[model samples]
Target: MVRASACGRPFVREGAVSAFPFDAVIFDMDGVIVDTEYYYLGETAAFAKELGLNLTQEELNGQVGTSHQFFLRMLVDWFERAGKGHLTGEEALIRWDEWAHKRPRDYQALINPGAVDTIRELPRRGVRVALASSSPMDSIEEVLNACGLSDAFEYVVSGEQFKESKPEPDIYLHALDLLGLPANRCCCVEDSVPGITAGKRAGLTVIAKREERFGFSQDAADKIIDQLPELLTLS
Candidate 1:
């Protein structure tokens, strides 16, 4: 058993038990830990519009759980089709980076209804907790700090650190590596299709949050929940 100093809770890794198949829980940050999906979608949509491209809500929603680089590349392709073939992916990224950096502070929201309590409870119940998100480190830090969840996780991994993001399983695979746990002993919580696909690909039990505006499918998830608190009953 290992004890977490931040929350004063213990995580145990015992031999297989019949009741619970997992010994750890991995979390996806954006839509699952915080209500920031709307902000991201709005920002991306606005950026696309400025480039003379129209992005529908559904199309924007489909891009959830993807890395910024992936979306930037897609934007560059869109611009190319619109006769802006001179603009490279790097240029689009730079512009988007500037826009993101200059975003209003109030545009981000901190809403994780039962996140704090659930995370705090997990450690004491002998389950390791980790954060795996496609968001950049700076964005992850801001959200975690804003939501008072900076100390809730044992490990934090950003998809930006990986060459490939969600749907490729690199982030989740890296997180399990950091946790020192095997895939079968961990469960992943996600709120987007890409996230769910990543978790499943990593061989972890996936719990999909169904309340988010995007990423809800029975095919990609092992189970579905409408609220964070419901995860407490998994064991």
Candidate 2:
């Protein structure tokens, strides 16, 4: 028998979900739900350049799916490493935020192939889905609404709502709490290393989406796929 907590009562668990198959599906927003990775990467690079720092693709890749504070801290560390120790923490943060806000709002972030169809199909198959991301609430809402996925998930969790982000279990744990399911009864889908780490740490089964540019390892993920379409068949 499943015991319901006040935090988890509104979510429904359907289908033949058990320890092996997983009952609820939790997703990471940026790369998993939509292809916003490139936009974020480009923005980060441009922000670094504006600070008179040349940030390589490799450096930017390491910060994907992380919170803004983490990204800023990493940038500060990188600046020091690049012999730009004169740049203060406040200066770096101001420049990064300025660049982020200046990105054109009309830019179409990459939408993954078959994302809409897959999300739409999940409910018919009796699977419960939710979104767990490190992005701000406003950004998540904009992307989901823009991509027509706003109504697909029963819950949308923002990493900004938590003190800890990916690589920590807080976000995933929070999602599971919202879903009213045990860790073993949930499946987490993620496209980045930190997202995967968060899911695994929360004790949920993890599916890793292979991103060619980021080069994620398969060791931590329970299942690996090259695209989001594969998830439709997993449950």
Candidate 3:
């Protein structure tokens, strides 16, 4: 699929998303908005390395675009299967919690460039905005408060509040419901395949925020862009 430029120029490609009717935008937090993906990865990798359970790039990619709870389980399982740790699942989870508390993310350093402006600009364009994130509520709150955008969104829903996370469409669907907007009138901003899947499955137009931090991609999205403000044109 060809990506459109801010000036509305289209390059050669086969993919085409429906032109704008989006009255609302649903954003995924990690790589798309707060740029917390790398911080999470760095912290996880350091913890794994300390246990002699260094994760390869592929292993890291496997954990991206999902809730921290799921990621922790997966990491613990990997640690056991790889003969890297003797901790029980419960013990492993405790270790993760301890580490998270010890190393709270520095939200200011991680905020994605152009993210705030992009979000604030939406309302001016007559578009409503909400957040659908896989992070826990506390983490989401910290991000919103630290980024100085706690009031920018109309609604903020965490996947932790839902029965399912990304790739399940629950969070996005909930956001749409709360916004009182249909999928066709909303745009989903995502940075991973699972997030894209959730958005598309919810019948919303999905815009993939391209980043190399995860090194994962496929044909599941409706659009792709290199950064956040690149979407300002669509707004």
- In order, what lDDT does every prediction score? 0.76, 0.75, 0.76
Looking at candidate 3, what is the lDDT of residue 144? Answer: 86
Candidate 2 matches the true fold with a TM-score of: 0.82
Q: How do the predictions measure up, each by TM-score?
A: 0.83, 0.82, 0.83
Residue range with the least summed lDDT across 10 consecutive positions in model 1: 1-10
Off by over 4 Å in 1: 1-21, 78-85, 105-108
Root-mean-square deviation of each candidate, in angstroms? 4.6, 4.6, 9.1
**Local accuracy of candidate 3 as per-residue lDDT tens digits, 1-235:** 0001112122222232334367778888888897777777787788778767767988877777877558757767867866867766578877778767987678978888899998877767666677888887777878888998887777778887766788898888887767777888889999888888889889999998887656777467888898888887674
Poorest 10 consecutive residues by lDDT, candidate 3: 1-10
Q: Which stretches of candidate 3 lie over 4 Å from their true place?
A: 1-20, 78-91
Better of 2 and 3 by TM-score: 3
Tens digit per residue, CA lDDT, model 2, 38-127: 677777677667667776667777777777558657768767766767566678767556666766654244678877887777766677
lDDT of 1 by residue, 1-235 (tens): 1111123234454433234457789999888888777677788788778778877777888777777668767878877866766577788777667877887655235576787788777767667788888887877887777777787788788887778788889888887776778998999998877888899999999998875456446466989988888888776
Candidate 1 TM-score, true structure as reference: 0.83
Distance from true location, Cα of 35 in model 2, Å = 1.4
